[model samples]
Target: MRAYADFVVEYKLTVEFPNFQDKIYVRDGEELARWWIAQTNRPDTIFCANDEAAAGFITEIRRAKFSVLGDIAIIGFDNTEVANLLDFTTIHYPVDQQAENAFLILQNMLHSTDKTLIPLEYTLIERHTT
Candidate 1:
């Protein structure tokens, strides 16, 4: 949310954060699809917190006779197996790198007390869903 807020501020874009007051999961995303269709002016794109939610959103939209990346676009995070299977755009989270960093941190901890924190980074894996 903070990252999105920063992006909106930096670009001076008017974006609305609708309070669905529910966890951002597959069910929520499905519900969101219904809400989206009810809107007179629908958003051009949606940024889901995870691929599962995005997949659910895609399924629901397609069921409603809406075309992917045609009626709306979607971007999801945590490029999971579903993301690849669904061919949706997502952020490739560096799980392997994070595990390696953890190991290095532990090895260093045994020798010294210096605590180090690696920066969080992600790669955008573009796919047709975007």
Candidate 2:
């Protein structure tokens, strides 16, 4: 998640994570939202690790009387179908392509085939949020 923090910094945006004062962890969605709102000073953009976290954040934000993608832009990773249905902007990791590449590699290793294999590709799928 440090890398994600660095990404926000590079983009000239502020980020905040839930406090972790101990080894054991918790996922209190409301607490996380409060911390994030306080730390970012209610910034107009938020980035979450996954769609689930983003969904939680959005719920809290809505409960706080804030409009999603209107007052703030929310983005999550892993282009899940739910994210698409929710019109979320996400990182579209090529999972199918990756599996294909892995299968090709394993097949080549298991059998001496002279067939050429194509590499996997990835692209960002833009949506409602920026």
Candidate 3:
């Protein structure tokens, strides 16, 4: 969340925070949909915490007789299988790479006293939803 806010500030981007955040889960997204519909002024884009939540959000949004991109655009993190299945934009966070990096760092730490860590990043996957 801090990185997101810092990027927004650094880039001088205009983004609204409607306080639509919750636990990372499909059910959380489903529940948040109700609050989203209640708002008179809705944002065009919503960044979900994960693909599962985005999937849930899309499901509920469509169930209410609204188009996914037609009504709103969705961007999820962790670009899991659901992202490709749903054909929505998402941030491809490679957990495997991070895990490998961490393991290497740990192995090095065991051998030597120097224990340095590296940072991982996310890649944006452009799709129909965006």
Best by TM-score: 3
Q: How far out, in Å, is residue 4 in model 3?
A: 6.5
Which candidate order results from sorting by lDDT in descending order? 1, 3, 2
Residues 1-130, candidate 1, lDDT per residue (tens digit)?
6777799999999866586544468887788888887888898898887888888888889999999899999988899998899899999978887897898798788878565767779999999977
TM-score quality measure for candidate 1: 0.75
Evaluate residue 63 in candidate 3 and report its C-alpha lDDT on the 0 to 100 scale.
88
The digit string of per-residue lDDT tens for model 3 on 9-94 reads 99999876556556589887887676678778887888888889888888888888878888999888888889999899999977
The collision pairs in model 2 are none
All candidates' TM-scores?
0.75, 0.59, 0.76
lDDT of each: 0.84, 0.67, 0.83
Write the residue-wise lDDT of candidate 2 on 38-87 in tens digits.
Answer: 66456678666666666666678778887787788877667887678777
Q: How does residue 21 of candidate 2 score in lDDT?
A: 30
TM-score of 2: 0.59
Error at 84, model 1, angstroms: 0.6
List the candidates ranked by TM-score, beginning with the highest: 3, 1, 2
- Clash pairs (backbone) in predicted model 1: none
Off by over 4 Å in 1: 2-17, 20-22, 99-112
